[model samples]
Target: MFVGIIVDIISAINMFTGQVIPARRWMEPFLLHNQSILGSVFYVITYGGRCIQGATATILSFCRVCAVCFPIFYQKLGQPKYIYTMQVLQLFGGGVALVLLWKDEYEYILEDNGLYSVGSDETNADWFYMFVAIMEVFFVVVIVLNNLVTYTMFRLKFNKKNAMKNNGVSPISSQTNQEKQKRESGLDKMTFIVCLVELIYFAYIVYSLQINPYMNKRIFYFFYNILCVIYSTFSAWMLLIVSKPINTELKRMFLIIGGKRLTRSISISVQGSRDNHK
Candidate 1:
């Protein structure tokens, strides 16, 4: 929630600097011509939430896969310094992207004229597009590698379970073995879902920005909104489901509450018994 709030604040600053500030100075040329306040609010809420949620989801999934793939190294990754370093890198990268994107209204150029055809201006735009392409490729590669590692872990766990079962381990003694298999299966399914979603998002974005030159901005906006909302909701739901610690904490809370109620009832009954005896 804190991360999401920070993302929202950052995005709000970006919007204010881009639109509201420019509007105040009568610099209408810098504002998005088609942007209404309603549209802006909708875009910010959806996209801002999506950015934070997506990053959190991806990191959580990566950590799970990492734990299975490299159990020995997982603890090291959780060091405060390392986690802080990662956060700083994420913020820095986002800041750079925003600066580059907002420098001279590059989005307006793309929105109006579609993909650049040819010329110095077109060449510069192409450079930016290619940069985005390279980053997308890198991201997709990481996702693929993560999926592979997780699936390998799943197979290893399955084989281990089979071996244990063949050795006639008691079911009670092997409860953890069974649970591990379930966890692997769930993680495998999650990997597939995440990869599929990422592929679809990349395909849509590439098509909107590069392939379909004649596509309307409204259509692009519609797809972008749908894509982001799906990503955000699915990402959050998956984490909530897969995170055993979260479930355990919830269970612990309930148990504490139940225990207190039982204790109170027992005390009241004891007092009533003493009174009757008296």
Candidate 2:
């Protein structure tokens, strides 16, 4: 997630600087024009980072599904070192893409009706996009499978947990177990949303890029926002929403502050009333 966020940030910079700012011509200090150093860098980060994020997201969804369907094996394979190694390999894959495109010419090439696109020259462009598209589609497929597995496991566990409760198990154990199950269910639901959103967003992105490769600059920039910043923003908020611990902590903090202010107000009111009475 952290890596995704960083990639999104760089992509946003590329989008606005390379495309949006130039289109609007609003206080344009610099332009990421064709065959420029900055343009090359933007292409590298935008494409390469996309590959990185796509691959990692698929891995993440797989991990979650594994946790649900094969908890024992998931635990065995879920060590920090192992996960880190996998992440590094994913980065390496992206790095390869980056290296390939590092020297490739980037251009705000002209589109139909005098519009410009934030992309590379014809050379290596076709296969590069195909590579990114493949990873994105692979991620969608994997996440869909993961979603099915997670939903099945969640439903089964939910039914079993409810049955135990209805059977009048020990009150304390039942409550404790129920709470645990609730947390698990919440996580599963979160995973469901994550997978569903991934399916939707990636499908939209891929479809849009394919069907309409040439468009007005503003429209393209809007799509860029959807591709990176907006998606990341949604993920962040959804994470906060699904995180019980974070929600609880935030609620506690708010309560503490509210209580203090209420108590102080009451004390002030009481003192004023007494003074008026006396």
Candidate 3:
């Protein structure tokens, strides 16, 4: 997640430089000469970031599955070493995939209108298109399957709880059941949100695929770049929203800031009163 954020930030800067700063005469030469390098950077960051995000989604799905289907083993899965190893492996795989899929020979050229554009070889472009299409399908399928499994687990748990209530389970057991239900409810909501975002992202990928590559409109390119940044950030934003601990910490931070401001205001008012008396 941290890597994805950093990559997205770099992608944003690259987009800004390419789209907004190219008009400046002083920057044109430097920009033109470095366009290919920037293009490669953009390519790696954009696609690599997507791969990272997809891995994150996959990991989350796996954790959700473990929590639901194998709760006993879930505690073992939470070990720091296990998680770190998984992340390291995922990143290594993503990096390798990016290198294999990226077109290193592509060049960026200066347009007559003083803009820099990345030019891809036709063969490489087609390969990238196919790669993205396959990845889109794979991600969509995985997320849908995860959602299905999660929903099934939720239903089973719900029915079991109802059955226990009807059977007049002990008050202690009932209280425990309620607490479990609350936790499961939150988890269900979070999983739903994650699935929803993944579906939206899948649609965006399809849209990009269907659109003709020959259009070459600046607006289209700009919006596409914006979408890429959004794609990288959306999952993290949703995670933060659905995470209780993060939300609580955020509220606490805001309250602290607000308290400081309030104290400053009171001090200023007191000082004004003192001046008036003087």
The numbered model that scores best in TM-score is: 2
In model 2, which residue pairs have backbone atoms overlapping below 3 Å?
none
lDDT agreement of model 1 with the native: 0.59
Give the lDDT ranking, best first.
Answer: 2, 3, 1
- lDDT per model vs. reference: 0.59, 0.69, 0.68
TM-score-sorted candidate list, best first:
2, 3, 1
Model 1 worst lDDT run, 10 consecutive residues: 111-120
Instruction: Mark the regions of model 1 whose C-alpha exceeds 4 Å error after superposition.
Output: 1-62, 106-126, 241-278
Candidate 3 residues 1-278, lDDT tens each? 56656655665675666555653334665766676765666566556666666666776687778888889988888699877976874575358546754556445444445464554666675666667667767877887798789879888988988897988999888888877776667667877767776777777666665555554445556666666666656666865666666678899999999999999999999999999999
Candidate 2 residue runs with Cα over 4 Å from true position: 26-29, 32-35, 78-81, 109-120, 215-217, 253-278
Give TM per candidate.
0.65, 0.78, 0.75
In angstroms, the error of model 3 at 96 is 3.4
Tell me the spans in candidate 3 whose CA falls farther than 4 Å from its real position: 1-26, 97-103, 106-116, 169-187, 206-223, 260-278
TM-score of 1: 0.65
lDDT of 2 by residue, 141-196 (tens): 87788777877887887789778878888889888887777677677767777676
TM-score of structure candidate 2:
0.78
